[model samples]
Target: MEKDAFAQQLPVEKYTRNIENKSIFYVIRKEGDLTKPNFIVSYAWGNYRNDLVMTMFGRLMLLMVGLIVISWLPCLGIARYFTRPLVQMERHVGRMAERDWHEPISTSRKDEIGRLAKAIESMRQRLVRQDRAQQFFLQHTSHELKTPVMVIRSYAQSIQDGVYPKGTLNESVGVIMKEGERLRYRRPEIKWEMDLAPHTTLIGDQEQWKIALENMLDNQLRYAKSCIRIVVKSQSLDNENAVKGQTSLSKFCISNDGPLLDQAIADSLFEPFRSGGDGQFGLGLAIVKQIMDHHGMTVRAANQRDGVSFYIEPGKQTDKTSVPKVS
Candidate 1:
């Protein structure tokens, strides 16, 4: 039984051949003394060493690859986290520039990109408000202009038919009633004061100036708590821009004792149908602006301690006789 077990442990037989000769060798060893050997075995040291080195090298390469993969995971996550918001922001800004009014992006990130997103969203909201205000302006403009036009047309037709239209009398009555109603309704009993520049005139359509003044008065009436003042004065000219014989400019100001206008509202007041305090469409000021533009005059609104003032500056000189006096 001992000999059989030793045979099972022995190395398989092998041989090597060379040009010189063929030979056989067995690599064997005994656990005990060589002289009293109990077991021996054949082994190939060169092949075994080669196999071991190959296995070790393959394992080392696998370890390097795994380490690289593990390290790359966190790097990839960080890069994506930082750049994703930036990419989204770029796309969103492009859309806004194109005037695309899509819903704003929602984000809760507490980073720079998040702040940028919030700012962009705010701008979009402002644009939306303006857009809504523009729609309101169009609707109001249609209604306001249509009534007057229809009434004027009807009156002209009736007059052409040789009929002394009842409108002529009714219109006068209507004006009187409107004035009476305004006096009763306006609070604080607004006083009217006029400081006219005698014979201050420009070469422009008188009718247009009348319309501009009426519009200004209408606005002042709506807002005035105590008094409305109209002042006309000659503006001294700069020597460089004025012709030596040119007449001085006539500066007209309409002021009211009312609440001061906000700086933002004052800046954009003359823009057609701009939104105003209480969301009222500013068509009155717009009309004033249009008439002023036609006559080559500049108009601006300014805040005062007690109220607001609007000034109209003439663009050119005209003979003093051309200007009409205000009652």
Candidate 2:
């Protein structure tokens, strides 16, 4: 048929043909010589196509199974690699929550997990330091309170036994009263004059600033003879760059008509548990200093002409001469 005609005309060796809408493959090979007869083989294309599809499908299945089997251990190892640090971190955080900050988080990997571990370790160190400091503060506070309490108790006991510890009933009672006063909380008299500028605003923690201001006022009231003055005003600052114009800054000054502070006392005024002119060691001024430092503000005491003055302002300027007077 068409194959025979093609073979006779062109000496076909191999070819595919469509007959009656069915594909077939033919192969012809020379046998002995030009005159000798040749061999011809033919097969239905459907059989070859089916065999090819089956072979390819089997190989593809085998390859996929091999790949999965080869990668199984590696996949598991990678999963553990990522999850192990997370599990350790979870346990560490749990311990930290329970206030156990003894162990340190350690990691050598230069990745996100490493950074997280370092940060947690830093936080743990800070918490440890804070806890130690709190303990120290409590110990000192208890000691300070215990002295007055013991004094009061002893004086009261002596009076109850009909004995004057201070040589007289009134004197002994006065000693008790003095010790009791140390433990008593009294409201301020609020007799100081305030010259606050209208709409004056300062950027700081309100409650902390209140504590600091109250501590300062309490200190002044304890020493002031009669008059105390508070002044709040906004001062204009000339910017080094003219294009930036000027910035307004708030200044606070409190003055009391009290005895001048000794240079030694003024130098260590903000130190914790330091005794003031009244021979009373307290944390009030120390708390004020801490609050001011935390808010990035500056506070300084200066011996004014007639009394003592405290200046609270922003920035690192500690020179009293830099502050403007609002008299």
Candidate 3:
């Protein structure tokens, strides 16, 4: 067993000639005299303490064993460190695949592997920024179209309800046409906003910002009974990466206070089509979130004891506008 333990640490050809059928075994025995009641002093495998010389067949076998060990043994050991980062990288890749980017390569080592890890992490962050941008693009478009629709829908309903005088039918139609034109023209302004800033800047779209602010305020106005607190602000965290670094941000945020959203609902409050009140369409907050993202800001909703608060940050809103992309 002792010999076996040693051989196990080695490869197949280390102790045997053939990889197919191997020869290696260990035994245990008792110590003292040989004649001591069937007791064995010790045990060994192919025990010999002399130089092994042999014929061509035997020499060929030994040569093969030497080559295998010399070539591959050291490789296995070195490969462990090289493979370690790759394994960790694989884990990170899987996590990212699951749409998780909360963690990045904080590795500070200066090596090829370390550099590769940082590069991958940087790429991931860029994708995250893109996500925010896409949401803003969509949100801007939807909100612009919704405004006129609201006005027209209201007027149309009012007319049907006898609230409109007989001579005002033409006025209602004119207002509807005006609202329709705004939707048709300004609706695509989101795409125009996106083209104004380079992606590396992590820029924000003004269209998206307005949509988010309106959503928060609208929600508060609809459900808060009376008071609705709305706030918009921007700031940047200093980058530790600078030789003597600066801040970087290109966006803003909108927050509001109302009845506390349920914990479960708040967690997913930014998701589209999610509602928490008596009954709602649930798209309001989702759209707000979508717009905030395009502008490279994060959206957070939390239940304040008396009401609720949401926060926003601009992609380029930070005072340190020169922060590096990777640490």
- Per-model lDDT: 0.71, 0.77, 0.58
lDDT of 1 by residue, 88-196 (tens): 8788888878878567877898888889888888988877777778888788767766665566666656666755456576664454455445333354578989997
Model 1: runs farther than 4 Å from truth?
A: 1-72, 94-102, 146-191, 199-218, 225-227, 236-247, 262-273, 283-300, 303-306, 312-327
How many Å off is the CA of 260 in candidate 3? 2.0
Could you give candidate 3's per-residue lDDT for residues 9-44 as a string of tens digits? 222222222234543333434344434422222332
Residue 10's C-alpha lDDT in candidate 2?
41
lDDT of 2 at 142: 92
lDDT value, candidate 3, whole model: 0.58
As for TM-score, the candidate ahead, 1 or 2, is: 2
Best by TM-score: 2
lDDT tens readout by residue for model 2, 20-49: 887887665545456665655555585788
Q: Please report the TM-score between candidate 1 and the true structure.
A: 0.52
Per-residue error (Å), model 1, residue 126: 0.1
The worst-scoring run of ten residues by lDDT in candidate 1 lies at 10-19
Per-prediction TM-score to the true structure, in the order listed: 0.52, 0.55, 0.34
Alpha-carbon shift of residue 17 in model 1 (angstroms): 38
Residue pairs with backbone atoms closer than 3 Å in model 1 (clashes) = 201-323
True-vs-predicted CA distance for residue 166, candidate 3, Å: 3.2
